[model samples]
Target: MTSDTLAPAKPAVDLEGITKRFPGVVANHDIRITVAAGTVHAIVGENGAGKSTLMKILYGMQKPDEGTIKVNGEEVSFRTPSDAIDVGIGMVHQHFMLADNFTVLENIVLGAEPKKGANLDTGAARARITELGESHGLRVDPDRLVEELGVGDRQRVEILKVLYRGARILILDEPTAVLVPQEVDELFDNLRELKADGLTVIFISHKLDEVLNIADEITVIRRGTTVTSVPRSAVTDARQLAEMMVGSELPTPETRESTVTDRVMLDVKGLTLSGGDGGRPLLSDVTFPVHAGEVVGIAGVEGNGQSELIEAIMGMRALNGGAIHLGEEDITSWATLKRREAGIGYIPEDRHRQGLLLQASLWENRVLGHQTRPPASKGIWINRKASRADTERIVKEYDVRTPSVETLALALSGGNQQKLIVGREMSGEPVFLIAAHPTRGVDVGAQAAIWDHLRNARAAGLAVLLISADLDELIGLSDTLYVILRGRLVARLDPSDVTPDRLGGYMTGAITEET
Candidate 1:
């Protein structure tokens, strides 16, 4: 055997004493981690715990103030992401960076297209992508537009993009945040195949169960430092990992006995929304009633008009034909601000896009949805004192880890941003709330806290429409569950008895209404 084949496996990456400092945030301090080659190393931490910062340092997006980075047993310093890529490191961000107008093959080969005498080598690129997809179990059409693909396909294309760039090590940030149960399983399968092919994978997520499932080693970062790194065999369950990250008991997402009442708080009747440019209807006769103190859950694969439904209810979308009733008053003709004024609260799906202005201060974002109401505004004037005070209250009550209320929303972690959104939407004591993926990117602790808040609100006679991709959360927190497929309600399931698999079957159209 050759000397290279005979030697022991080298550590794919070694980060020692990684310290990165922002103005008010010590993002990472004395962080250390090691990933064995050809193994899946999972990193877990609370929001604002500095996990993302450490990953950025490793991926060369941010330079560490004081640290040593070693790749493949050789010391290296990366001044830019291209430098990291040159040494076989690639990163896939939580938010996709693909162009919607481009095809999959075009996106994969955008920056590093193979050359043929000053011309792009399209055939070679397609062949290589096809080969990679076949080997990695990430099959997708090369000619399909990114906008025309599903969430899972987009994720697969992202993985392929990394592999096509000759990267042997992959860094995935919150890869499964938007995937349904089945899609997560498929992604895990692809990851395992990649591991089998001797590629190193760095997986960062707040989902401990998934970490335990796929990780060969688990590293926990707490409060800007590495708390512990252990083999998968060392930890038994998610509770152990959760406690290590939060220094407290892991909170469960189960709700109490039915707080549901007979009074209908918000009622939708024959809601229909036409697609832009005379396409098919986005929402077709979607009707449901959320009673006071009841939590009505909506479950569906993404891009199936859930956003349209929420927008219609929030008055952001103009409905073709429908009547929305809030406690016996037809509000379909009301404007968006009027809906907000009438006690209808909304927590949108994309926090960065629809929830908060990232460039604004936390207290400023607190004044967003309630800009016209108390503690935020007073007769054409912004009430800064009351707004700042209430923002601080939310920071304390919701356990948002930040230095001060004046900090910009962009500086906070995704989970912290999500926490702020939940706190803002739950404020103003709205009689009805629309919570879409309330705990999407939060850690177990934060997720539990949000669930507790929602449960408390439900008990206080606030009607809620809960939407989520986490099946356990959807099934556990919802008293009544409705599945929307292709803009229509396909199944009304009993959450008490349905399993994730069965619900996923309904979501993917594998199970018909008759079945």
Candidate 2:
């Protein structure tokens, strides 16, 4: 069927000339969009392209400087998120706003608790939540604690929250970012079911493939303006969408010509890390070796000791057993800073928490790792001039989009922030690199750039331990792959023979055969 035939009889949300401005930047400029009911509209853009700002305006989190919003063809203004909720509009933020200690039912009914006879009617709330989840295909346990659930399960709880509030239009920001491939497929299936039942979904994502697969229409935003809004059938493929997002052809990486070296650079011998609360080992007997000019990828569903593995390598977490050897030296007892000085560079999984200081300036963050070293600081006094120059060089080299080095790290987009972190970590010319979820929230364009950079680093005789939840990315980048299931190495494969589906099966503990 044609898009027009499939579209709702009436537009669900019509935004005209939506303009929002921050102190020094015009975030959204004269943008116009129309999302029809019972349809999935995908918004695609580069980091810092103002897609988030536009969605915030729609969700009543931010006020527009100039705009007109029509819900069901009726112009209305929303003073708060509650006002938007009253009109059947709900937003699921990228970072889940859930209380870890609270039960799922409590979290879903937090703001608007059910009451009967001057007492909290939790039983009725739980029943309603269960019904909403079952009817909408978003299965969730209302009594489970948030801290005990996986990332995908937490997202389901968020969706149930909105459904319980009787929302017809749902806004999901990067919903599938933390999910595995299978979980992503299940989410898409649920979304299709919701659309079939006459629910309007606004899906914001950087992954073009998911957008093309799920969205009826796609909108491209560039530099705080709507570049184009076209039906999905009109666009040829992801390459075209990527070009539109970045506004240029991305640089391709040079193919590796050097033969893989046989010299081992780092080795892990039965490494084990105990969980904090007297639990079992987060990483149990995980052994791997990385050679020069090689990339060894660790692929698995997240929280299966990926974070613990990286932390053990960096010496941030205590190892319960075994040792880590860098070349010929035993460095298991070394401090994190000592490991860094001994030719180890690490890109952490959570950029906001472990990599960049959001409130600090870009230049300050750039030189944070090198503050006590030469060129950045001499003893206690920092060399701001040298640091700014270095920051500028890193920004240009990494294609980081920022107005100035003096800008706060939080002001930059997610992709740019990640680029800055990667650039800083890789700038020291370390012999070994440990990258954990390096490209989690990056766009395709940036993802390509990062892969090229890592490949180049590998080609230059650096040993890389790449950990990721994206199986496709892992297969594409690594020469060898290993699977981790419940803190144990379950299988290994050569990248040439492994498929994403097979890897996904192993990652979720469905299949355990080695190829």
Candidate 3:
């Protein structure tokens, strides 16, 4: 063989000495990583450790202050996401971007539509999308509306959307954050297929178990810098990787103590809501009582009335028939604001929609749920000084990583934003808390801290209604667990008596009460 034939090939991606800085936070500092061609490269880090910032730089959402990025051994600079797309780099964000009114094909070929004399060439787009989906293990109906798809199906559409845009490299941020166990397995299988087809994937996630299971190589980042990069085979267990990222072994969500009291804090009786679908109700005959010092968990697949149930309890949605009470006060006729004042804390599933104002500063967001009361307000007047001081307290108590209380909500990482929301909701000593996916995108370290807070709150006689997609979390922290399927309670499981797989079966309706 010739000497030239024996030379090694160039890496698919090489980021060297990359540095990024904000006003007071060093988002990234001298970061370095190299990914081999056609391999699955995983990035693991804590919430505010600068994982998102590095990915933003890679995807051209932000530019680095120093260092270089090389693709296939050739140096390149990206001024915008469009410039990054031109070089075959596509990014799938944790929060998906798609129009609910658009069909699958329309969303897939939206910005880059092929035209047939001033009209959209949808036929060609549909054919290409179908082919890409089938070949990549991501089959979906192109004619289906985006609103009709489930969470997993929606994720598949997102992956397919990037694949159809001629991307050779894909960056997925927290892709499995909302998926159930089976859906996660399916997503991993699809990723394996993509890797087999000679496409490179850069995965960013805080799930160490999933990272170890899927990644060919894993890079750990801590405090805005790369700690180490090692092959999956070289590592023995998730503990090593967890320690590398957070300087500790993975924290369990398990709660063994029983802090339940006899006092009923939140009572929902015969809760019913019309879905506007002929005769079907969105939430049907849901009756439950949460006691003081107890954690009652609701588990179900996405879009199976979990969100609607929360809305009903929080008085955001008008119930066709139901009665809600907080410690025997019939709040069935109360408004959302009235419920808030009645000591019902809410941690919404979609933080951006119901939690915080992204454009507002941290101190301003502190007044979101508790506005018009005490620290956030003073006798129907806004208390900016009190808000700022209390925001500082929450930032310190909740370990929210931020440069200043004046920082905008959009400037923090998803996990930090979640932490801030958690702190805000737990304030004012609310008697009842409705926590929906509280740790959805948070890292393991932050998740542990949040769990600790929940435990402490429960011990202090707080009643909680916890709704989550994570089976382990539900089974671990719940004193009482109820399975919801098609807007009805299917089973009430003992958290300590069930496994994640078994809990998942009930959540997905595969295991019924009859079975």
TM-score for candidate 1, residues paired by index:
0.97
Instruction: For each candidate, give its TM-score against the true structure.
Output: 0.97, 0.93, 0.97
Checking candidate 3 for backbone clashes, the offending pairs are none
How well does candidate 2 score on lDDT at residue 376? 81
Higher TM-score: candidate 2 or 3? Answer: 3
Write the residue-wise lDDT of candidate 3 on 1-515 in tens digits: 99878979789899999999998889999999999989999999999889899988888999999999998899989899888888889999988898889999988898999889999988899899999998999999999999889889999999988888888899999999888898899999999999999999999987889999999999999999999999999889888888888988899998988999999999999999988967668899999999999999999888889999999998889999979999979999899998998899999999999899999999999999788799988887999999999999999999999989999999998899999999999987899999999999898889999999999999999999999988889989999999988889889888989988888888777888831
lDDT per residue as tens, model 2, 1-515:
98977954778899999999876688899999999889999999887788888888898888999989999888989888888999999999878899999999999999889999898898899889888888888888888999778777888889888888889999999988777788899899889989999999999998787898999999999889999999999988777888888865543323335446999999999998877788766888988899998889998877788888998898988888989999998999999888888889888888888888999999999886667665688678999998898899999999998878999998887888999989998887889999887887777678788988898888889999988876677887787789988798899887778787888888888988742
Over 4 Å off, model 1? 1-6
Global lDDT of model 2: 0.86
lDDT of 1 by residue, 1-515 (tens): 88977978779999989999998989999989999999999999988899888888888888999989999999999889999999999999988999999999999999999999999999999999999999989899999999889889999999999999989999999998878889999999999999999999999988889999999999999989999999999998988888899987777778859999999999999999988788878898888899999999999988888999999999888899989999988999999888888999888899999989999999999999899999899889999999999999999999988899999999999899999888988887799999999998788889889999999999999999998888888899998999988888888888898998899999989987731
Give the higher-TM-score candidate: 1 or 2: 1
User: Superposing every Cα of model 2 onto the true structure, what RMSD results?
Assistant: 3.1
TM-score of 2: 0.93
